[model samples]
Target chain A: MSNTLEISNLSKNYGDFQLKDVSFTLPTGYIMGLIGPNGAGKTTVIKTIMNLVMKDKGEVQLFGKDHRDFEIEAKKRIGFVYDTPNYYEHLSLKRLKNVIAPFYDRWDENIFMDLVGRFEIPLNKPLKKFSKGMAMKSSIALALSHHAEFIVMDEPTSGLDPVVRREMLDFLRNLMEDEKKSILFSSHITTDIEQVADYITFMHKGKVVFSKTKDAVREQYALVKGGNELINEATKQHFVAVRTGAYGFEGLTDDVSQTKKILSNSAIYEKATLEDIMFFNNIKTKAEG
Target chain B: MVQLILKDFRVHALLVVICLAALFAASTLYIALVLLSGNGFKTELMLYTLITILSSSAVSLLFFIQDEMFKTDAVFVSLPVSRKQLVWSKYISSIVLLLLAFTAHFFGFQLGVVINNGVGFEGAVVYEGPLLWCMLLLAVVAFKSYAFPLYFKFGMATGGMVFSVFQLLVVIAFLYSLQFETWTDQINAVVVWAEQRSLGGLFGMLLCLVVLLTSGSMPLSAQLFKNKNLGT
Candidate 1:
């Protein structure tokens, strides 16, 4: 399968914070989740891909061409939804369409009007008067109106209530059902990523702590819980991280089958969620290096 | 590009209306003062006309350039429009708006003068020659001092103060030049030379406007926006 995006050795540095060498690829017809904690440089990574922020060192290729070379035509095929709606405050939905429609060759007014109706966005009200949820929906509608192949969202679900978040995710999933589109979204809400992502890339402290297929992340890592005695030096070496408590201990491991073979009689294995894997991986990676 | 220009005008519609009204009112007031003074319309009327043209051009330039640099610029950059198209749209729109404002102010001044001083004042004074020179100087100054710096810095509030100071210095230099002993003779000599040359002054001014806009704004805007950190 062709890759929609290929990032290699991407790095950016602020005087105090730095994004170390990061590499990843999102294949076509897949949803890649950029999972990370706050200040993990998730937004920075997205911005660099969109060329909203300059990269210190690295290359980003979108659809087999360097991003800089693609220029306006390349940008036409990509949709970007920033965390904050940065549109002019005085413009209404209709006004915004008038401003944005003429630029894109594939802008579908019918699709835009449909989204406005479906999302219940008021067409006449100024955007500054929109509720947070309404503003987010409007942004999504705008993104969808353009016939873009690659959609990148930054913290799209942040500050949203459960119902609104679900609706937004459902809309995105439906869009992905066509199989010709790809999405790269960054979020701290692991459940949202867990629900739609085919691939997961976990970043922490400006580095990729772990990256794998969603099923692989679930299959490779297991939460082993048992008595404190079960957490021994030999077993610890096999596990990524261990949490000890008064009653028992739980740990994460990538080689779940191997760890199970060694500690067969002592620990009980449980399925790991993406969040659990990230937590343990972050702690373990920090501890080891 | 037309759509972008229309959108920009819509965004600043209120400011445009206010600018038009102010120009109309100022022109009427100046003409009334000139007529009611009872002395034959003096040559200073041309100076007043020059001041009005330059001031209006500066204000309009500031407003449009500021909006392009700071307020609506981020969205413009992210759109499918190329940076060149965006820059050209602003440049074209500013010139159009400036022309419209200048025409309205000019006619309004003429109407007021005609109403108060009768048809006799219509051909009594020759202001067109000076007015054209004033506009050319204003265009060059506006592009260099306002548009170019605003494009480079990407913030009107930050760049505007420096532009204002520079304009003040230019004005001070012009005033200082008038202190020379032969200033009046020099002015007459240049005017005579220009008249004999026929459209040389206007051509020189047009060339300066073109050079300032092409070499100053287009490249500055493209370069600054090409590598700018838009997320900021």
Candidate 2:
């Protein structure tokens, strides 16, 4: 299957912060979660792809076309939702819809109206009066109304309550039932990503750590708990990160079999959640720096 | 481009109405004072020109402030429209607004003239003529051309502060020039020369200047906007 979005060697410098040769791909009909700790440049990647932030050097292919050369055409097929909805808040939802609807060639008024009704967004109230959840729903409705083939959302689940976040994730899953739509969802919330992403791209400190299928990541990474006697400076090299307690030690390793070889089957191995992977990686990175 | 232009109008429809109403009120009051003062028609025209220009600037600035509040720049850039289209939309919308403000002033001034006629004020200048139009267009185009680049480069609040300082400097220079007879004579000389060549020639020259400034301003604004980090 063709890739929905392909970014290679993306770089952007903001003096104190930078995105360093970031690269990733999302195949059509899959949800790729871009997960990292805060300030990891996930939002920057999304912004660069949408051309909201100009890349210093890179190639971005969206819908199999160079993003820069066919920017208008590429964007026509993209549904971009910002972390914070940046709509004119003084206008009512209906008025805002009227203003934005004409710009998209495939905008479906019926779909928009239906989403508004289903999401229970008020058509007559100004967006400033909307709750955060309502505002997000409105943004999603607008993004989807254009019959967009690929949607790039930046931190959509942040600041949301668990129930609302779950519903939003469920809605995204339902959207994927079409088998042609793809999503590149950026979020710091690992649980949210774990819940909905078919693939995961982990990033840290302006660099992409790994981009692979979620099942592969799950199978490859593991958490090990064992007595302190089983740990040493040599064995520590096997774990990406290790935390020691008074009586025991817990560690994260990307290669379960290699870690087992180092530990000699003494440690209890458990599946590493996305949170565990992110936390351990962060700890290791901070320790190294 | 039309959608982007219409977006601004629809979003700021209330503000536009309020500005036009205020402009009408100001125009009506100024026209009455000019008629009551009984024959400073030249001064009246100048004052009216200043009022319309200031009103247009104020309206556009208010619209920009609204845009900043909503982070509309970020939203627009994310749309299918190019940065060039976004900049052109602003220029077009500003021109449309300038024309709207001019129309509002025209109707208001005409209303004042009708009222003055009823009050038996025969000596009042009935029509300010094409000079007013030329001055109004020149002031707005020049100001917007200079200001838009600053705004696109440095954002609305900072650019506005700088633009205000520039306006203050221009006012100071104008006042300082008034104290010098030679400067006044040179200006008068130019005006006399232009009128000698016919007012149409002068109007055409001002319009050409407007076109040139606007043409140069647009690409600069577009280029600035293209690299602008919106949320940054």
Candidate 3:
């Protein structure tokens, strides 16, 4: 599949933190989940894509065009939903929509109205009074209404309740049925990523740990559970992260088949969930530090 | 761009009405005083007109403060338009609003003369007022030119403070310049020049200066906004 976005060697520095050589691609018709902890530079990456923040070194090509060279045109095709969505909060949704509609060449009032209807948003209420979910819904409505080919959201599900998050994930899934839309969303909620993402880009402390297909991820990492005594120092090295609970021991292994041989039927190997994969990666990074 | 300007007008509709009313009240006072005393209201008109224009120009500062308060610049930057377009829209809308204020104040002065004096001011005097009005607009434009570059560099609050300081400095400089003999000569020379010139020439010169200062400021604001690391 052709890529909708391609970021190569992306980097940004902000005194105390630096995003080092991050890169990723979201293929057409796929949802790429950017999973990272708080302050992992996910928002920075999203901002860089939107050119809201300056990148020290990188190439971000959207729809095969350099983002800076064709900044306006590239942005025309981008649907950006910021984490907080702080617009002109004093303006009502209808008024804000009018304010924003003129800038986009393909802005469809009908599509915008439809999205508002789908979200059941009150058109006349200013966004300042909106609940967090409502604010996110409004931002999504704005992004989706412009016939944007690529939708990039920064931590959109971070503070949402599970029900709203599920609804959001389902809505994104429905969007992907169109086969031309692509989504790149950041979330710490692994379940949300598992529910909708075809690909995962895991980041930690301003660096991309891995970018892989979800299926490949499932096949790559295995959760091995066995007795505490079964865990040796030599065997622990094979696991990305290890936990020795009173009941038993559970650890994650990227080399699942080799680990299965090393453990030799003493431990049970199960398919690793995205949550497990993310958790283990985070633990592994912390352990190394 | 129209949408944005319209938004500004909508947001400040009440303020605009209040300002226009104040202008009328101030103009009526000046006109009534001059007509009853049988002397020109030039000094009084200059003071009141300066106050009206300054207040109107100050209202434009709310646009920046509002944008900053809500962090709406973040949303704007995320929009599918170039930063240059955004900068141009703001500059044009602000100047348009200043013009609107100038126009409203002119009408208010005219209306005030008719209402308070029941007889119009002298043909030459009333026609000559636009020259001073042009200068008022130039002052407001100069204020904006000084304020906006700082606004793009810093956020609204600091820029507002800086602009206030700029005004204070202008006042202080004027006070200091009064102590100089050359400054008194220049003031007399300007008064003589004003008496010598036609209203058209005075207005044309002030308008040209206003346009020059305002136009010059646009590129500075645009460049600052372009280089700005607008945070999300």
Candidate 4:
């Protein structure tokens, strides 16, 4: 299967913030969620892909075309939604859409109008008056109206209420039904990603901790908790991260079968959620190097 | 798309209107003062020229600020266009705005001259003999030399720094133009010098110089922008 987006060895430095060598791929028709804690270079990776931030060294290929060499052609096929509303607040939504329409050949006025109606955005009101949720809906509508096959969103639902966020995740889920559409969404909200993403790339401290399908991770990674008697240094090697409590200890292990064999009726094991995986992965990576 | 160029003008149309209105009111007041005072045509003319440059600069400044709000962020640059096209659209828009500023200034000056009742609706006396176009274009070109490269490099979020520098230079140029008699005498000598040489050659030289300076900077500005990050 062809990949919709491919990034290899990307790196960027902002004096204090550095994005170390990072790589990932999103196949067509799948949602790849980039999940991380705050300040883990998630936005930096997205920005570098859009060429919004210059990379110190790396290659980003969107649909097999280099992002820089064929920037215009490549961008024409991309629908980018920033975390913040990056639009003229003084202009009304329709007027702002008008300003954006002529840039894309595939821009559908009817589709945009449809989204406007669906989102119930005030047509005549200036964007400055919009609530954060309303502005995001408008941005997503604009992104979709361009007929782009791939959507690159940087924390699009960050500040939204839960109801709106659920609606957005559902909308994104429906978007991928076409089998030709794909989304690379970055977010700190793991539940949102866990609900829709086929693949997850967990990042911590400017480095990618793990990138795998959600199913593989969910089936493989486990959380095991027991008393201190169940813990030993030899068995500790199997755990990715360990946190000890006064009466008991809990640990994250990637191989559930191996953990089951090692702990053997002494501890309870449960499937790891994206949040558990991310939390433990961060701790593990930080402790190791 | 042309939309990128038009966005700034659309957002700040009110500010433009207000600035132009102020220009009209100030010029009218200056004319009233000159009519009553009755003894300082030379000094009055210099003051009028100074106002023209300042007001024109103000209009462009408003447009620049609004443009910065949209451009410095990742908003517009994420549009499906090359940076070259984006830079070119900005240059085209700035030139059109500069022309608008100069035209408004011309009208304000003519309004003063017509009211004065003896100057035949001419603001031509301010700069002297075909030099108005040359000087206006020169001032705009010089202003943009730093403006274009700085905005491109720093994404116009830092535009205020360069803009302040631009405003300072405009003030200095205005103060220097206070030696109006000396400039007029120099223009007279240059006109005679041109007439003595081939007249067409001097006109051609000025045109070529304007074209060279502007056209050359077009690519240079685009080149400066191409490698830089869009969101500063």
TM-scores, all models, native as reference: 0.87, 0.92, 0.88, 0.90
TM-score values for chain B across all models:
0.74, 0.80, 0.72, 0.73
Pairs clashing in candidate 2?
none
Model 2, CA-based lDDT: 0.83
Q: Please identify model 3 stretches exceeding 4 Å from their true place.
A: B1-7, B10-50, B118-128, B178-216
Give the Cα-based TM-score of candidate 3 against the true structure: 0.88
Q: Could you report the DockQ of all the candidates, in the order they appear?
A: 0.46, 0.73, 0.54, 0.59
lDDT of candidate 3 over A210-263, digit per residue (tens): 899999888989999999988989999899999889999989999998898888
Model 3 CAPRI quality? medium
Error of 4 at A56 (Å): 1.4
Write the residue-wise lDDT of candidate 2 on A1-289 in tens digits.
9999999999999999999999888999999999999999998898888888889998999989888788899888889887656567777889888888999999999999999988999999988898888888888998999999999998998888788798899999999998999999999999999999999999999999999999999999999999999889989989899999998999999989988888877899999999999999999999989
Task: Rank the candidate models, highest DockQ first.
Answer: 2, 4, 3, 1
Give the candidates in order of TM-score, highest first.
2, 4, 3, 1
lDDT of 1 at B147: 50
**Model 4 / residue A211 / CA error / Å:** 1.5
Q: Candidate 1 — what's its lDDT?
A: 0.76
- Tens-digit per-residue lDDT, A49-162, candidate 1: 877778899999998888777767768888877675655777887887776778788999999999999999999899889887888898888877888899988899998989
The TM-score between candidate 2 and the true structure equals: 0.92
Report how far residue A105 has shifted in candidate 2, in Å: 0.7
Worst 10 residues of 2 chain A by lDDT: A82-91
Candidate 1 CAPRI category: acceptable
**C-alpha local distance difference test of each model:** 0.76, 0.83, 0.78, 0.77
